[model samples]
Target: MGSELEMGKRPPENAGNTTQVQNTPPNTHILGSVSTQTVDLFNPPSNACCFCWCCCCSCSCLTVRSAKDKRILMTVSEKQEDVDTNKMPQLTLEEVHAWGESFERLIKSAQGRVHFRQFLKTEFSEENLMFWLNCEDLKKETNKTMVEQTVKQIYEDYVSVLSPKEVSLDSRVREVINRNMLEPSSCTFDEAQQQIYTLMQRDSYPRYMNSSMYADLIQSFEQLNES
Candidate 1:
């Protein structure tokens, strides 16, 4: 009974004052050292945090869980072109070995094409392979209308000097392409294709043979075969 009476008693500081206490909201309570009202956990104010019921005015309790891992994120360089290199088809040991036999063999295989394309990318001449690939696709099209459209698109993408993906071509080849543009056909890019093919075979293919990407792939497959 004495403890209950002590709890109900007011502080002695306001004993002789004429102040009258007005009734406030029933559940609101002053919290923290600075007398800020505690926020409702269910519907906290915008300035307050939902994870904690304490007012942001004076509360200093920890609010969030500590981070568990610090991962080193790999950044893509600005020079990296957006090329799709996924979904590589399964390759046989013989097929992979054949890529080393000749540049002609590598460009003909689907598996070899992607790997070689990537290798050319490192040399900053992937555009040459892309132009070659586009021309090959253009050759397959029998529709005259589509042949015209694709030839024009390929010219804009690779043959034109204005194109960012333009491949290096001699003036003679460029002049032939300019004349061919008047009556666009599947064979419009044949000369340019031959030039790029020779360029890749002579320059890019040899380096690609000794490239780490090719070496690692062959080593991995060889290791797999042994086991």
Candidate 2:
């Protein structure tokens, strides 16, 4: 009988072909093709096409951005609604009586401020009170840009000699303000505000307290209260 190996195995003539097939891995071509096509998932290409896809086509990212925009729009809309709803409160009889009791008390109230402004308008010295009120409002502003704008506005309206609405301020105070304007601040008009405050306190307050307008307003308040 033939040898067991010789009977079971292929002949030497085909052995070379069989060996060559066995030495090559089953997925060798697949691995070579895959390596050439391999993508780096962690470090994507920084092309405009990819960027556009990320910004426009990525649903999760777009959703987050759109939600942020909606929130901003909603906030602005709510602020506008609040401003629209904020009408001035009406003056009441008790408020009028409290205001009548003292000049200090009168200037503190919004209603009293309005009435006092009207009184000042008649006196032709309304700019003084207006400037003081503007300064007060300016002090309340927290934004630097807005503060700067307000300072400029106040300077033009009340400090400039050429302005018809210029408030009466001494040369020393004007000089100080001019220097302060170089580095404008919320308190740029502080000295001027104090001067005007004193002017109103000394000159306008007593006269306003004793004026026919005051008497008439008091009478009106009483009638309104009685009714």
Candidate 3:
């Protein structure tokens, strides 16, 4: 009752003539001092609060998960391409080896033709050769486009027929062979030869595709100069 009266009779210190009385509790003075000196130790910056922590953690997890998913997708795409090649007709080992050999021979002959054509272009007279020059240019342009199209076809076909699980080294080699052979711009004579040698050495062609049929096709094409 006495404390209540004291509180009710409290007055402002600056009220000089007013009926003023001190009503502040003695313990309140200690509380005020403690509160002022003891800083808010756990208080964080606005950007480092609980909501921010949650957001940061969530974002980090999502980023990691997304990266994993991307890697999985890329792996799946490659595997699908391998699968596509498996759907292609299987060839015996002997046939694949023979085909590889035939392909080598064809590549050699093609290189020879390229050399010959270049020689002619260099040595032939330029006078009255406008038509010939145009023809040569057109031929080169057509060949370049054809090779690009062929590589694309082989890549597509390989990706279409095989199961992702079954696509293996042999399939990869076949795809590489097709790609290398068709890439006229990048497949130099020496590079093509090296590719042929590598594939033949692997000895995977015989059992992977119809190696014999492929060999015969190559031989026929080479003999007829029908490339």
Among residues 3 or more apart in sequence or in different chains, the pairs in candidate 1 whose N, CA or C atoms overlap within 3 Å are none
Task: Report the number of the highest-lDDT candidate.
Answer: 1
Which residue runs does candidate 3 get wrong by more than 4 Å? Answer: 1-64, 79-203, 206-210
Query: If scored against the real structure, what TM-score would every candidate get?
Result: 0.61, 0.59, 0.18
Residue 162 CA displacement from its true place in model 2, Å: 0.5
Instruction: Give the alpha carbon lDDT tens digit for every residue of 181-209 in model 1.
Output: 77788898899899888878877788778
Q: Going through the candidates in order, what is the number of backbone clashes in each? A: 0, 0, 9
Model 3 lDDT vs. the true structure? 0.28
**Which pairs clash in model 2?**
none
CA lDDT of each prediction against the hidden true structure: 0.57, 0.55, 0.28
TM value for model 2: 0.59
**Model 3: ten consecutive residues of lowest lDDT:** 39-48
TM-score of candidate 3 to 2 decimals? 0.18
lDDT per residue, candidate 2, 1-227, as tens digits?
13211112122332111101112333222111211112111111111121232122333433333344344333321221121111435455567678767777888876577667656655666667777877887788787766665565566556765466667777788888878877778898898889878878877777767666566666644543454
